[model samples]
Target: MTISNDLFTRAQELIPGGVNSPVRAFRSVGGAPFFTKKAEGATLTTADDKELIDFVCTWGPAIHGHNHPVIRDAIAEALNNGTSFGTPNPYEVEMAELIIKMVPSVEKVRMVNSGTEATMTAIRLARGYTKRNKIIKFAGCYHGHVDSLLIAAGSGALTLGKPDSAGIPEKLAEETIVLPFNDLSKVEEAFSNFGDQIAGIILEPFPANVGLIFPTDGYLQGLRDLCTKHGSVLIFDEVMTGFRVSAGGVQEHVGITPDITTLGKIIGGGLPVGALGGKAEIMDHLAPLGPVYQAGTLSGNPLAMAAGIASLKLLLEGDAYSRLDKMGKQIASAIASTASEIGLPLQVPQVGSMFCVYFSEKRVDTLDDATATDTDRFNKYFHTCLEKGVYLPPSKYEANFISTAHEQGAIDRASEILCETLREL
Candidate 1:
């Protein structure tokens, strides 16, 4: 048996589902999940000693790619100072400052241990600020497993065929109004029905968890207007898209501001971190100043802050986003062109460095559409790419990522392989 297979056998004996995360189990795509020994640039050296051209990019961090020297040096420098401090450190101030400077909507920011924490805090802060109990989230928009945002969520939940997670109180789930994405009418209807009760509306701006679906024209702006009209906070869950999409993320790219923005992924520099940033007025509602209480001892770990600062600085250094976009298009276009040639029903909705392949004849714009994707064929395609040494996201419901570390040659090779695999299928 392969070393990865052996590792999985051991992992399942201890770790539930043989994986730390549900998607990592590869249940939707089938087959044993390979364990990675090391990663560098845009590749993962698997436990079996096979180097796979990584398109997952550590599930949407690694904008500069795995084990980047710059980020590594920053972390090493911070390590010299020590790990976590019970009190705040200089890195926390710097991270907060950097976040405020980069993301247009985030005036004040608070660091947390993970994207889930950031999102959870944002929800509580919103409710506290607006004095309301309900939150509206789009169907298939996964906001880090916060109980209130788990209704009809995406990511692992969608992959596992269970959108509404168990264990959440029925009343808590009721307070979360789940609506169709890319459809402003549903949001308008929700607001008309429960305008006064809505504390906030949280969304992924571009729903990457459910295969990178973008907002239709004016759809985001419409939500912005609705929140403003109702006095409800608009929360953009950019944990996936945040700094990876742009210096300011989708808010900056599309020019629609949100009251609160949840950030993680690239901002953590592949470390465990998350932050909630927003108007000072709303953020001040959090403890020490307001009633909403959120705390974490490891919120601003020096290593994560240092690494994230380095990652953000790298983006500010050159035309990194443009380069990543070019690479993304190269792969996305190749897949599209090949699928067209083979007359295979396909749609690869891509933006910046995030994209997903949907084997559907029509374009995908809603959660239902994403849920109804051709997973049967996609399972075949995913395994074929894995065998050919390209590692995409394990499930069709997840977004595939590209990074600046992906050399032109690597991207070209990946594109060629992906297209060839599609044709063969």
Candidate 2:
């Protein structure tokens, strides 16, 4: 057996599904997951000593690419100052300031340990601020595994949401009104029915979890208007898209401002970190400022903060975002056109540095449309790409990411490998 296979065998005995995260188990793509011993630039060197071009980018955090010297040096410098303080630190304050400056909707920000904590806190703050219980989320937009958000939409907007996972109380699910993405009429109906009870509407401005789908034109502004009309907070869950899509994420790119924003991934600089920020009024509702209670012992680890600051600063340096965009377009456009030419029923939806390959004839915009894509074909393509040294996101449902590090010849090679696979398919 290979070293990675041996490690997986050992891990399965000690950990659930032999992986800490479900997707990392490679259940959807049909293979044993390779354990990476090291990463640099846009590639992962596996335990089996194989090098593969990585498009996952550590699941959206490594925007500057893995093990960049700047981030590494920052982390090293911070380590000399000691690790945890359990009290307020300068890093947290600076990180907060940087977030406010970049994300247009974030006027005040609080650091959290994980995207789940950030999202959970955002939900509670919204409810506490509005003094209402209901939260409206879209079906395919994942905002962590918070109980209220772990819901699937019912038959219609007026229907109560159903639990998408086990162990979640049915009553808690009802507090969330899950609706189909890209449909504003359903949102209007929900608000019309529960206008008085809705605390806020939270959605991924770009639904990255379900194949990186973009909002239909005017869909975001429509939601913003409804929230304004109903006095409900509008929350943008930009955990996946935040720093990866652009400095201000979808809000800046599309010119729509939300009342609250949850962020993670790139902001953490490949470390465990998350944050929530919004209008000062709504944010003031938390803890020492107001009634909503949220606390994290390691909210802003000094090491993570220093590394994150370096990552964000790197984005502003020269042409990182532009280069990433160029890489995204180079690979996405090439593969998509090839799929079309070969008569493969495929759709590759991409934006900025994020993209996805959906084996579907129809364009994917809704949860139903995304689910209907042919996973079998995608699984074959995924394994083939892996064999040829390109590592994409393991599932058809997850979006792939590129990094500034990909600008140096990686983009062209990835495009060639992907097109070759499409032709083979």
Candidate 3:
């Protein structure tokens, strides 16, 4: 057997599904996952010694690309200081200040261990601030593995949520209101009926988990206005899109301010980190300041802070975002052209460095549309591209990221491979 296959066999004996995360199992793409030996500059060197052009970008953390020297150097310097200290560190303060400067709505911020904690704390803070229990979340917008947030829609459009996973309590699910994404009338109706009861509305402004789906025109602004009218907090889960989308994220891009923003991925600079930040008035409700209690021992680890600082500093360098956007457009346009040439219906939604391919004629503005895409054809194309040395996000439902390391040549190469793969299909 191959080294990766052997590793998988050994891993399955110790780790559930032979992977730490479910999606890493490659279940959606129908194959055993490959183990990476090393990664650098938009490429993963597999344990079996093959190198592939990486589009997964560590699921959105490797914006500067894998193992960037700046981030690595920062981590090394932090190592001299010590990895973690129980007491607060200067790096924590600096990181918090940086976040406030980057994201405008965040007048105050709290560090957490993962996206789940960031979202969980945001939900609790909202409930405490509004004195309401119910929360509304758009369908297919993943906020993390938090129990309350791990819910799906019930039978009807406006029905109370049901647990998407087995371990989540049904009572917690009951307090969650599930609504179809991008449907403003349904949001208005829900607010009309249960506005007073809703503590908050949480969503990924540009939902990436279900595919890179964008909001309908004015849909996000409408949610913001409705939440304002109802006195419910609006939380944007920017775990995937936060720094990857822009230095300020979708809120900054669209000019729609949310009461609370949940961030992860790039903020940690490839380490484990998450943050919850928003207006100080609402954030003050959290402990040491207010009644709501949330804390983490490694919330602001020095190493994570150093890596983040370096990563953000690199992002601040000249024309990084412009380069990322240009690369994304290049790949997206090439894929569209190839699809047209092949007489195949395709939808490639892209913004900045994030993009996803949907083999469907319909525009995927909502989760329903995303789910209806031609996943079978996508699966075939995915493996074909992989065999040809382009590593995509194994699942068709996930978004593929273009990093700063994805220079024009690399982007063109990946695009050519993708087009050739598509044509073969």
Which stretches in model 1 have alpha-carbon errors above 4 Å? none
Report the C-alpha displacement of residue 333, candidate 3, in angstroms.
0.1
10 residues in a row with least lDDT, candidate 3:
154-163
lDDT of 1 by residue, 42-81 (tens): 9999998999999999898899999999999999999998
Locate the minimum summed-lDDT window of 10 residues in model 2: 154-163
- Every model's Cα RMSD, please? 0.8, 3.2, 3.0
What residue runs in model 2 are displaced by over 4 Å at the alpha carbon?
153-163
Q: Identify the candidate with maximal lDDT.
A: 1
For model 1 the local lDDT of residue 354 reads: 88
**TM-score computed on alpha carbons, candidate 2:** 0.97
Model 1 clash pairs are none
TM-score of 1: 0.99
Error of 1 at 274 (Å): 0.2
Across residues 133-198, which tens digit of lDDT does each residue of candidate 2 receive?
999999878887788887762111111123276788888988999899999999999998999999
Steric clash count of candidate 1: 0
Deviation in Å, model 2, residue 154 alpha carbon? 15
For candidate 3, the lDDT comes to 0.88
